[model samples]
Target: MPGYLEVLIILFVALLLFGNRLPNVARSLAQGIVEFRKGLKGEPENQEEKKALPPAGGQQAHGIPQGTQGGANAQGSQPPPPAQQQDPS
Candidate 1:
């Protein structure tokens, strides 16, 4: 650990370099410390887990239409048929 005189010298140098920007620098340093502690605690860095999972009800994951999959029709409705294309001469 730095002695008192060494700490004072470091603070003097920082003041000379940062001048009026010292408060902003200090704020950023404090925030970095907070995030570091959160990381050490294994906290999730984002809110993704707070988001709702896919409903327990549907064919959503398999690229199948919502109302048709595994012989189940969500709305008891049939999907529209693919259009027949006629070639133009």
Candidate 2:
């Protein structure tokens, strides 16, 4: 266990290292904790409007088409082979 003096020294070092950004770091940490707690409790993250909206036509929830992969050649078709160039003698 650290003594009071040792704790104070550690805190002082932390303050020096984090100087102006400490408050922002603390705020971000708090927000992360709140989000984690909400996840544990199964609470929605303010996405009611998004949940109510319908998915676009022919698209899944992730916006990708239902029957196709996210590629131009999603229909299992292969590209045409390139033509060979003739060498000049």
Candidate 3:
């Protein structure tokens, strides 16, 4: 880890290179950290990017075509045949 003097020297060099833009750079860095934390928590910071991603499942984001079901349970299964009924006296 760097000592206080090394930290000051690095800050001074950054000030020399970034001058008035230092605040903006710091703000950008803080925003990046916040966004990173949100991502780590399984949340997206950018709604536009979220909106642009494909929807869940195999269906397209646009719309499902005419008569096709778009999920796992809809794939391949048949109902059991009905049981025979007995007449009551």
Evaluate all candidate structures by whole-model CA lDDT and list the values in order.
Answer: 0.79, 0.83, 0.81
Model 2 misplaced regions, further than 4 Å? 54-89
Q: Count backbone clashes in candidate 1.
A: 0
Best by TM-score: 2
TM-score against native, each model: 0.39, 0.45, 0.35
Query: Please, what's the RMSD in Å of model 2?
Result: 6.9
Residue lDDT tens for model 3, 1-89:
99999999999998898899978989999999998899899987778999888887755445666456545566555567889999996
User: What are the root-mean-square deviations of the candidates from the true structure over C-alphas?
Assistant: 8.0, 6.9, 13.4
Deviating ranges (above 4 Å) for candidate 1: 1-17, 52-89
Residue 2 lDDT (model 3): 91
Model 1 RMSD in angstroms: 8.0
